[model samples]
Target: MTRIKNILSVIPLFLIAVLQAQEVEFGEISKEELLEEKYELDPDAEAAVLYRSQNTYLQSSGGGARLITEVHERIKLYSKNGFGHATETIHLYKGKSARETVGKIKAFTYNLVNDKVVKSELDKDQIFENEYSYSYDQVKFTMPNVKEGSVIEFMYRINSPFIWNIDEFRFQRDIPIKRLEAELRTPEGFNFKQTHKGFIFFTPSTEKKMDNRLGMDVVVTRFDLKDIPALKAESYVDNIDNYRSGALFELVSVDIPGTVYKSYSQSWGDVAKTIGSSSDYKNELDKTRSFKNELDPLLQGKTNQLEILKLLFKYVKEQITWNGVDGKSFQNGIKTTLKEKKGNVADINLLLVAMLRYAGIKANPVILSTKDNAIPLFPTLDRLNYVIAHATINGKDYYMDATEEFSDVNLLPIRDYNWGGLLVDNPNKVWKHIGRIAPKKADNMHLLKVVVGADGTIEGSYQSRLTHHSAYQFRERYKEKEEDEFLNDLERKLSNIEISGYEVKNAAGYEGNVTESFTYEMENGADIINDKIYFYPLAFLRKEENPFKLEKREYPIDYGFPFQDRYMVEITLPEGYVVESLPKNIVMNLPDNLGKYKYVIRHMGNKIQLSTIFDINSEIISAVNYLDLKEYYNQVIIKGLEQVVLAKAANGRDTGSTGNK
Candidate 1:
């Protein structure tokens, strides 16, 4: 009986192998897949990757060697939400002289109709190309005749003249993947260093074989993985791509006979030296004559270094507007940028550095990856995408980005709040870290005065003050909005209350705080049941839902900044009513002072005063503390739901018992 059981298990395994081999081939759709309504492992999944494979190798000729990557992917759509998977986008890199090209594209969508498979071929004319940036382009296409329960497959080849530029091979995505296979082949003349990231790790099977076509030995690395769960997105994550599972190949060295040896991978110091010596970077900074005429006049009578720094900073900000492009090197030279009065991030910030140096202030360029871009896993020049200016004033470093008009010294745009940046001082030839030691802060204060009538109508005057990041965000949102439109939206958000006398102060200024005041009237704001009234003290300001809902999280919670929110409210009870119940005063704090919450209430004659403060001190909470954080939010929600009760008094005297609810 035991032998029979073992043989039965082997038979199932062998059958599964046969089925996988037969069903996963390109351009072939099995009946079982087309008829399947949902994925077995994740029934609610919108789509699933049926199969994915990639082959990367080098092609050498008398002229030179080029890299070629062949990719094939098959996906199944289970519902309308999965229809987005039918559209695919491929990003290509453009070089100064040559660019990567995609060709030999083929795709088809298969649908089950009347128990038969119908295939629709993709039209080549439907494919379109778009310029994404100065260095990148996108090739996009949608599958023809796609619908629910349809399987789509596509195959393409990318040819690159730059052999060292090997893009990362991703094995995980936002949707579940059943099987993934990848192979990389390289000749003996080149060496590569590979790095893997994310929670899932794959050990590639490596081997060596002689290539008869090239008459050389090649190293082949193969990776095969099955059943990879999707990387679920969660709230408060800085960048989802930072936690993706993938492998990146960086060319380490090239050693060929009768040719000089070249090394591509180097330490941070070496990378800094290479950047400093580059003609496009250091040479551009040295060309101070381009802006000498304007900058010299701006700093003519400015003797103090600090004053000169501020003058130059303001001059660049007001002079050149950002063209909404992010780059590390100049797209238009400094001379043209000044002439056009607009340029990319590098153009504006580098010009600031140049002018500061011309004014005899210690300044340098700080290279960093924006929050949208993934954090740099290794020290490669390609990892840095954005640049800002760093200055030393009174023995303290101040980071500044002229692209943001409302930003102040040391208060960079939130996009620049990634891990850390590298300070590139060309003359000194030194590279050091610009740490993110201070957390960005925002403060909000809300004051409400409420009057409850015998008819159960609630009227109140609402005023709020915002500072720091909060003020910046408010200005960015409402700066372009019409007053009537802004009030309409606010009314909808504040529980459809009727609002009037709305006024906002300091909305157009970069200094001080933003203040907003409005009077409101809300119906059904409280429950009335014959001589008794019940209402929440916070009114529309209460937090109804908890943002942290995941049972378990793999990524850290990135709030981007630490913040404090406070509310002070005074409610005037209806005439001839006495307080029957009040919410208990409570205080809650997270471990190690990471966060705090406090609530207090006082019954002062006919007026009830309430105040609450909620503050989070740390910007990032690790995954290990996720449960604690989730529970903390749950408690806050519970407290906000507590109600205040009032009862009719007798003879204008206290008649109802007052106690904590």
Candidate 2:
């Protein structure tokens, strides 16, 4: 009996070893993984990350240190929708003298064939490289033979000469992750500040060890998580990545036993000082003789500071065209940019600032991260990606971006209306809120005149006026399209309608509101049953769906700017028809006056008039109030769907001549 017990104990240990070996590993494909059709945690997920591991450390080579990171990931596709996950792109940063490099890339796709695992290796020729910009390049590859019920895995290593450039390690993505493992090993000399964001909280285990290869002591931080849900995205979010659970490391200082200690970006002042002294930034602004001759003539007779500022802004906008590149530092010098007549954001906006300063207007450069880049969480130089011009006239601040043709003084592009920005003014750097202090209004009014026919068809004349951001968006979207194309698109949006006599005013000028008027005929716009006619008050302009559909939201809703939309509609009843009933007038207001909606309808002799005013005064609504906002929108949608009922006159005796009070 004792001998049997010993054998049973050994068998349990053997089984444990076998189970441990089944865990995912690099260069290994398992039959069980390939057979998994759906993830238990998120059954609706199109794909899932089965396992991921990332290890980053510093290695000493050739009397210098290089940052090395190794990554391995395994993913399973549940349907064709997940095929997009089969392709991977790695971004590499390039500098003037040294650039980051990737090597040792291997990928495979495994699928079950006749109850057996079959794997296809990626071909080396299938990998391709593209130059993303002057400072970045990307390498992309697709796994071979990827399909539903297939498991794909890839591993690669990146070697970076720039030791301070450490990218964030994200724990959450658009797809669910079953298992994750990450480690960061830093030597004793380098000091880094770690920052974490997102709704998920992760605690890292840290340890210290001696490294024989580097001949130094190092600290290791490790993170392990399982069954992490995907970061679900909702509407009106500025940047979903900003709310993703991740850890970022920023190099703060470097210290060596026998060498001088150095500090970097210890505060906002340090960041401003470092960038303000760079040749590509402040140096470019200092040399203004190249465009002085042209600017002098434009501002010679202009004595008003605001006028001079406007003139300089217009001159730079008309002179240089944006090349659609975003950078805080100029790629080419201002002289070359001026001569070429086209440059990146920094090249164009910085020149505008220089010209404004030369014109004796107090202007400076405002460095910020665009909406797509996410808000900067720390005071680091790399956190900022774009720059614009800021000027103060008559004690009022005006932010300008010359890249946008429809943008004017104090009206910046929507992308630049992020959290805030840093004003780089030498030693007097200050943080300024861009979109919060003064809301950008989107005032719009719609007037409609309609006639109901006996055949249930409707003819209407519609006119819309848009101002501020609304006008800017209208001009930006339809400016390049032909009138006929625009009309066709409108018709497609408002189904069952044929538009004619479409006219637009103030589309070519940036100073006034955009006006659009069109005549349209719609079939089946009203329902006529026996002697009664029924139709919606707002017609095609009614709100059919509420935008806030999520049960809960963890991120704030960013509207970019406050807006108001108003509609005034009138419908002349068909001949011999009298109004029987009208939808009740309703008014709803969000808490704290963040938003409001009003709808009123009136019945007159042979006519029905309806008006609605919808407005949101807050640029951003916090997630804490998401339920309130969602309910408010639901009520608005419900009210907009209410219909009006019209009854045929009794005895066909034109009782419609008497107004209903």
lDDT of 1 by residue, 218-331 (tens): 778888999888887888999988888889887777676766776666776666666667775678898888666777677778799877877787888889999988888898
As for model 2, its CA RMSD to the true structure in angstroms is 8.8
Candidate 1: pairs in clash = none
TM-score of 1: 0.92
Q: How does candidate 2 fare on TM-score?
A: 0.92
lDDT of each: 0.82, 0.81
Measured against the true structure, the TM-scores of the candidates, in listed sequence, are 0.92, 0.92
lDDT of 2 by residue, 503-582 (tens): 98988867679999999999989998887888887888887778888787888998888899999998888887787778
Model 2 has an lDDT value of: 0.81
